[model samples]
Every structure is written in C-alpha cells, then in structure tokens.
Target: MSLNVLAVDDSRTMRDMLNLALSSAGFTAHLAEDGLHGLEVLSEIEPDVIITDINMPRMDGFGFIEALRSDDRWSRIPILVLTTESADELKAKARSAGATGWIVKPFDPAKLVKALQMVAG
Candidate 1:
C-alpha cells in the first residue's frame, strides 16, 4: 500500500526536499508550515505517518506531538521528528511528548524513506 505522509516544517526548502524524497519513494506527501498548520492538515488527511521539524515559529515539534497525542483520533499515528538538533534532552522531550522516532536534519533520502516505512508498518 502507498503510505500517506504529512510533513510539517517552517522551511520551504525542507518541505520541498521531504516532498521529493517521499514522492520518489512512492508515498503521498502533504505539506504544512508549522505545528498548527500540521494539525489543520491532519484533519483533512488520514496520514499513515507524520514527519515534523523541531524548531518552528507558531508551534514547535514537542507541542505538536503533545497536541496530537492528546487526541485519541490521532494518538496512534507514527510521528518522526526531523531536525538539526541531536541533543539527548530534546530527544527525551520528544519521546515524552509521544514521538515514535527521530531523524536528524539533512536527512538521507533513503534513510528517511526507510524510517517512515519501518514506523508506519
């Protein structure tokens, strides 16, 4: 089955890159500017997985994950944080907020695809 993905990031370039990677790997990709936008997009699409950046203007990844986890309708969806930060504390925070996995920024296209498939499966 072709998995549907929601990619949330403030960076237009990052969103574009994610779109290219996900589409090339045979997944349908949806884009959102930030956490709030991600939530809005989430309501419209039943994404198999979600990929979000850590740092953002409106709402950060931690807030997004927390918000998503609070809702039973989307709590079980796999969320993978894509960011430049590799700090342990941030990862712990994300985990506590309900993230399924994490990927450092400048992500490898192949690895990103693999990570999504592994979690979404």
Candidate 2:
C-alpha cells in the first residue's frame, strides 16, 4: 500500500515543497496550513506519517503533539518534526512531546525522503 503523509506548516511554500517532495517519493501528501488544520485533517485522513513545523499561528507543533498524544486513536501515529528551530532545547521539547524524529530546516530532499522512509515504514 502507498504511504499517506500529512505535512503541517504555516508557510504555504513549505507545505507545497513537502507535498511535491513526498509525492515524488511515491507517497500521497496532505497539506495543512497550521497545527489546528493538521488535527482536523488527521481526523479525516488517517495518515501513516506526519511532518510539521514548530512555529505556527494556531497551535504550534508542540501543542499539536500534545493533542495527538492525548487521543488514544492518534497517539500511535508517527510524527517527524521538520523545522528551522535548531536549538537543542527545542529538539528535547519535541522529543518530550512525542515526536518520532526530527529534521532541521534547509534539509536535503534525498535525506528527507530517507527520513520519511524510516519513519513511515
């Protein structure tokens, strides 16, 4: 079966880029403008993997993870945080919030595909 991926970011450009990349990698991509929208999308489409940015307008990545973890239905979904925040503290926080993995911004597309493969599988 093809993998289904949900990409959540406030930036339209980022969402588009992720959509393109994941599609090229042979996965179906679903885009969300922010964390709230991501959650809404999740409720409808049970994606195999989720990738999100940290800084968003309504409900940031941390809050999104908290909400995901709080719900038993969504708690097992793998989440890979892809953000510009390179701070160690932020990485730790993401880990604490239930992120399956992390990818820093300006990431290589090949590496991103590899990461997605690792998480989504």
Candidate 3:
C-alpha cells in the first residue's frame, strides 16, 4: 500500500519540494504550513507518517510532537523531524518528545522515502 504523509513546514517552497518528492515516489502528500495547520490537517487525514520542520511560526516541531503525542488517538503515528539543525541536544529533545526519526535538512528525496517506509513499517 502507498503511504500517506503529512508534511509540516512554514516555507511554501519546502512544502512544494516535499510534495514533488513524495508524490513522485507514489506517496500521497498532504501539506501544512506549521504546527497549528498540521494539527488541523491531522484531524482530517490519518497520515501513515508525519514530517515536520524544527522551527515554525504557530508552533515549533518540539511543541508539535509533544502535542500530538499527548493524544491517545495520534500518539502512535510515526513523526520524522526534518530540519537544518543537527545539534545532538536537539535530536535528544525531539526523541524525548516522541519523534520516530530525524532527517537533516536539504534532505535527499530517496533517503527520506526510505526513512518514511522504515518508520511506518
């Protein structure tokens, strides 16, 4: 089965890139501008996996991860943090917040697809 993904980023360009990449790989892509928008989209779609940026306007990735993890219904969804930040502390924080995996920004589309499959499966 094809995977459904929710990609949350404040940059329209980034969202567009993700859409192109995931869609090209036979995955259904859903876009969200930020954490708040992500939550709204989340309510409508049951994504197999979620990809989020670390910094965002309404809610950052950490806050977003924590918020979703707090809900029993969404807690089990796999979340992957895709960001420019590569700080080990930040990775640790994301891990504690419930992210299933991490991908450094300027992500390779193929690798991102593989990571999504790994996490979702």
Candidate 4:
C-alpha cells in the first residue's frame, strides 16, 4: 500500500528532499512549513504517517503532536520526529507529546521508507 505522508518542516530544502524521497519510494508526500501549516493540511488529507521537525515558527513539533493527540480524528496516527536536535531530554519530551518514533536529521531515505512501511503499512 502507498502510504500518505505529511512532512512538517520549516526548511524548503528539507521539504523538497522529503518530497523526493517519498516519491521515489512510491508514497504520497504532503508538505507543510510548520505546525500550523500542518494542521491546515491535516484538514485536507488523512495521512498514514507524519514526520515533523522540532523547531519552527507559529507552532513547534511538540505542540503539533499534542494538538493531534488531543483530536480524536488524529490521535491514532503515527508521528515521527525528524529534527537536528539529538538531546535525550528532547526525545523524551517528544515521546511524552505522543511521538511514535524519532529520526535524527540528515536522514537516510531507505531507512525512512522502511520506518514508514513498518509503522503505517
């Protein structure tokens, strides 16, 4: 099955890279600039998996995850944190916020695809 993925990041280059990686893996990718933009896009599509960055304007990843977890429509979806931050405390915080997994930045495309399949397929 082709997984519908939502990638929320403030970087245009990161968004472009994710789009390429997902497309190459035969998955549908939806791009969002930040947490707020992600929420807006969430209204339009039901994603199988979500990949988000930690730092952003308007709303951060933690806030985004919390918001999603609070909504019945999105609570069960898997959320993966893709960020440059590698602090253990931050990971714990993200976990508490309802993240399903964590992946450090400069991600491997193959691994990301595998993770998405494992979690969403």
RMSD of each: 0.6, 1.0, 0.6, 0.5
115 Cα displacement, candidate 3 (Å): 0.5
Q: Superposing every Cα of model 3 onto the true structure, what RMSD results?
A: 0.6
lDDT of 2 by residue, 1-121 (tens): 3689999999988887888888888889999998999999988898888999999997999999989999998899899999999899999999999999999887787898888888777
Rank all candidate structures by their TM-score, best first, as comma-separated numbers.
4, 1, 3, 2
Better model by TM-score, 2 or 4? 4
In candidate 1 the C-alpha lDDT for residue 117 amounts to 91
Lowest summed-lDDT stretch of 10 residues in model 4? 112-121
Worst 10 residues of 2 by lDDT: 112-121
Cα-based lDDT for every prediction: 0.95, 0.90, 0.95, 0.97
Clashes of each: 0, 0, 0, 0
Off by over 4 Å in 1: none
Pairs with steric clashes in candidate 2: none
Strongest candidate by lDDT: 4
Alpha carbon deviation, residue 34, candidate 3 (Å): 0.5
> Tens digit of lDDT per residue, candidate 1, span 1-121?
5899999999999999999999999999999999999999998999999999989988999999999999999999999999999999999999999999999989999999999999999
Q: What is the clash tally of candidate 1? A: 0
